[model samples]
Target: MHVGILYSRIRRDEKLLLNELRDRGHEVEKIDVRKQQFGLDRMTTDVSELDLVIDRCLATSRSLYATEFLDSYGVTVINNPRTADICADKAKNSLALAEAGVPTPNTKVAFTTDAALEAIEEFGYPCVLKPVVGSWGRLMAKIDSRNAAEAILEHKATLGHYEHKVFYVQEFVDKPGRDIRVLATDGEPVAAMTRSSEHWLTNAAKGGKTAAFELDETALDLVETASDAVGDGLLGIDLMEVGGAGSGEYTVHEVNHTVEFKALNDSTDVDVPARVVDWLETKAAESDAAEAPIA
Candidate 1:
């Protein structure tokens, strides 16, 4: 099967997938998203021969638009555009998880600084203020006091982008020292890891240490529910431990599309890329069977 990897830059995560695909003898096409022009009806680069296009675009905007255009051309893209659309925005992510009856942190959204400040006040101090669209722990603040909340709100209000104006506030979970990141395919857990950090943001990209984690039945349930809520695809589901230590309860925070797995691969015994390819194979075969004429 021929697979197209959509990326602006091939990071370590992309490199792992590429190597695994090549080792498996699958034809791999490296499509540089920065250099590609995706038209409403067509893309400048031909994808007609490809069996599947895996979206690895680092930028959310690129991932969202690229998959949408590819879908329009009858090309199969993993983590479909609608899933991308919902996962790319924090507001949407929060809503999906909550609506699905998943135990997510209490969240509130406001469009203006005044309304945002009100939310912060209502939630009280030590809540979190996050950008509506971002990842890797960027532009997130743990507001500790009313003054701090006011200052952060002022700063966000002055920012020119509309995304900044849309404040996403959530009650801070008093997790221990780590959070779990589960790499799942259509809600099936491939591997799980714990990211530990001294900072409130425990993202691996934020310099957290990673180790393998075993998921419990409750976690498995949340993973499946959250995946369905955001629609299905390859995903990284984040959960923070709640209640007392070893409480065996979790609150899912986000579902990531175009999830990175090099950290997970290094920390766990699981063959991350190989399992991803296995899922890809299944998807490709499913696509083929669907497109085959009824006879």
Candidate 2:
């Protein structure tokens, strides 16, 4: 099978997957989304040569057209474009999780700056401020003070991208020690690790340290629940324990569709790439089964 990994540049995790596919005798192509000028015509022309596409590109509104084009052309993406679209929006993820009966953090989204301030006050300080659409913990802050909240809003506004766009703020959960990163494949927990930080934020991008953690039943359930809610082939569930929301309860902080697996591989006994390939094979087989003709 010819596989095209649609990423900007090949990272370590992508390299690992590439090696795995090569070992399995699959033809792999690297298509850097950033380097290519993509549109309906360009993508349809370029991607026609590949049998499948593992979408690893960090899509912005600008690059979304290409991703959508690939989607429309029925390219076999690891986690369908629609799944990425749903996970991209914090508010939408929360609402969908709620509707699916999956528990998420107490989240409040406000459009105006004043309404954002009001939400901060109401939700109380020490809340987590996140861009409605982002990844890798970018533009995420733990607002412990009213002034800090104002500053974050001002900073976001200064960008001039969305002067009046809403931001997502969630009640901060007090888990001073560490947070859990669970990668679920096909609605089952595959690998997990605990990320510890000297600072309050336990994001790996923010100088956090990762260590192996056994997936307890609760962690597995949380990961599985999030995967089911996403209804995708793969999902990365960020879970944390919080106080003050309710006694002895956990809330999901975020869900990532295109997850970084190298960190988890370092901290667990699981073969992250092998598992991903296995999951993809299962999905591919299912698709073939669905398309088989009646005898």
Candidate that would win on lDDT: 1
Whole-model lDDT values for every prediction = 0.94, 0.76
Candidate 2 C-alpha error for residue 45, in Å: 4.8
Per-residue lDDT over 8-28 for candidate 2, one digit per residue giving the tens place of the 0 to 100 score: 767788889999999999888
Worst 10 residues of 1 by lDDT: 239-248
Best by TM-score: 1
Which ten contiguous residues of candidate 2 have the minimum total lDDT?
241-250
Task: State TM-scores per candidate.
Answer: 0.99, 0.90
lDDT tens string, model 1, 1-295? 8999999989999999999999989999999999999888889789998999999999999999999999999999998999999999988999999999999999999998889999999999799999989999999999999999999999988888989999999998999889999999999999999999988889999999999999999999999999999998999999999985468999999999989999999999999999999999999999999999999
Alpha-carbon deviation at 3 in model 1, angstroms: 0.5
Q: Look at candidate 2 and tell me the lDDT of residue 142.
A: 90
